[model samples]
Target: MKTSGNRVWLTYVLSDSDVPNALTLCFSLRRVLTSRRLAVIVSPKVSRVSREALSYGFDFVFTLDEERNTAGLENEDFVKLFALTLQGFEKCVMLSPNMLVVKNCDELLDKEEDVQQTFVFAENGDSSILRLRPSLQVFNCLLKQLAKRNGTGVDSILKKWLSDQTSQLTFIDDKYNQHLHEKASFLREEKNIAIVNLKNKTPHELDYVGEMVLQLWKSIYDKSVLPLLNAVANVRNQLL
Candidate 1:
């Protein structure tokens, strides 16, 4: 695998249930990304076995410090914020585990921008696939806002924060982060989509387009992720 010194594809795993999604995302990314490195931030809720499986596909596996003040945040939203604190990376594409990369995303890292700015898909203005220059300053600013707006979802806080700085915010084409549950008729043709966000539903629950995307996701899981996970489990059992 090739490696880019300053660009990385980042994701997070907050629990054992998220392991499959993260691994699938990592494998899908590996298929399309040649130079960019892959990384994942895992919370304590994830098992050792799961972490081992993730380490197989991702170049870096970060552990979220349990001491961090993440109270009242659902799904360990605070862990995603840590992407900003990742020193040494010029650009980081933070993606949600539920997303499947359908094509090359190198164009995202090629965008020339300062650390004060952030790039996100126009679809949800959420963190489904966010591109930002890693900076401690921005990370702290978001943490302060998160505290002020207790009980608010991180996506809401991020949207409001970005809204406050319209000039610094860049909305990428919605094709980059298409939500699977949305009406298929409203979306661009499947060939143009860069990523598919399988919001909480399986392929069987979706329409034809969604079924196709989920079928691809399942294919990656079975051909790549599942085999790696099985190998990890086998090695683990032998040690025990």
Candidate 2:
């Protein structure tokens, strides 16, 4: 897969239960961003209906089995690494499924005159908006580096990567990666939250997304697309 001229956004689902959440993320991306090359890497555990729903929002859908090299990692969390193998993209942005885009991402990766790094990452998280120039060699190097480590989870691997590749990375605005540390404070500060992180998927988190989804729909699309997106979430919630 050689996607050297495309601007692609990548994400993945680990189980059938994550289908709806992933779809909501896709719909949110489609609603706010001008990019059309959104893709989702779904696992074999997801149902056909869930996959179909995924396809409705994304430009392309891939399965974990297709990404053989990414299999066998602890918790299947390494699945996000599949973005490196994505074909036909000049630039790739790997985003977590729970991140809500509060701003247009069309120029998210445009380098500033003062900047020198090759990557832009949303701060304070293992993974959020990761903008990178697609390179298989670099990804392979990271894989080998990760394999040599003793730690076995996404956060540990990510921290190691950041520490090792600090020269290549620049931080994006913290506002783009907001967290709900204090629920009341977050609610009071909704005006400042850009891309929210739904880490635990708590009820308030879902409710926050519910309200934001409506705002996104009203501002970009209509209410009709809500049911399908909601159905995807409902299905995943049932599995959870």
Candidate 3:
């Protein structure tokens, strides 16, 4: 699929139980999306994503079929589940599997300067169940794998935006009769954790965006539109 000048594309990755989540996301998203395309990456095990998603004319639909490529390697854990999803695209306006698109996002990718190669994402706080608190071993494994890649920026981009340390220590687990997480202390300060490339300077700060609007635009333009443009330019596709 040629991506040059394709406009923005909404990319989503869904699991088996996420069929309803896909429906909710797509129906609501269609109303707000004017210029971009919607690309859904679904688990092969989930038939609903393919069946129910047909009417939307998604720009592309991919499946999570691990049998087709690399597995068991250290990088597999980080990119394994997503490889099938990112099959043909280079850049994307990605959303969490559970996010809901409430407002129009046509010009959300509009950029300022040429700094559109950066990836924009929100931080999942320490208290957030949505964020993964990987074991030290898992952390090291992923870190080593990321180190070998070319400017993937996986490690620096992810941050443990912590929540109020004092409040976190206040909640005692009824079964254990003590705080499950470590008590707040100077060594284990949990607030004001900064996000990489973002203006996450304080507790009230939103996740670092780092010329977010611009970066988002770049991602959309490069991943969704640029390849299409190249294809058309080279006459790679007869339809173009």
Model 3 lDDT tens row, 25-107 = 45445655556666665555555424344324465676545453332333313432243235343344444433434445443
TM-scores for candidates 1 onward, in order: 0.87, 0.72, 0.43
**Order of candidates by lDDT, top first?**
1, 2, 3
Q: Cα lDDT of model 3 overall?
A: 0.37
Number of the predicted model whose lDDT against the real structure is largest: 1
Q: Given candidate 2, what's the lDDT at residue 197?
A: 65
Model 2 error, position 131 (Å):
1.8
Cα deviation of 66 in candidate 2 (Å)? 6.7
Cα lDDT of all candidates, in order?
Answer: 0.78, 0.63, 0.37
Q: After superposition, how far is residue 212 of candidate 2 from its true place, in Å?
A: 5.6
**Which predicted model would earn the best TM-score?**
1
List all candidate RMSDs to the true structure.
3.0, 5.8, 16.6
Looking at candidate 2, the ten consecutive residues that score lowest on lDDT are: 109-118
Residue-level lDDT tens digits of model 1 in 1-240: 323668888899999899999989988887885478888988888899999999889999998875655444554577667777887787888888999988887787777653466545454565677787777887778877787785677788787777787665667677777888776642446677888878767545567778778788999999998899999999999999
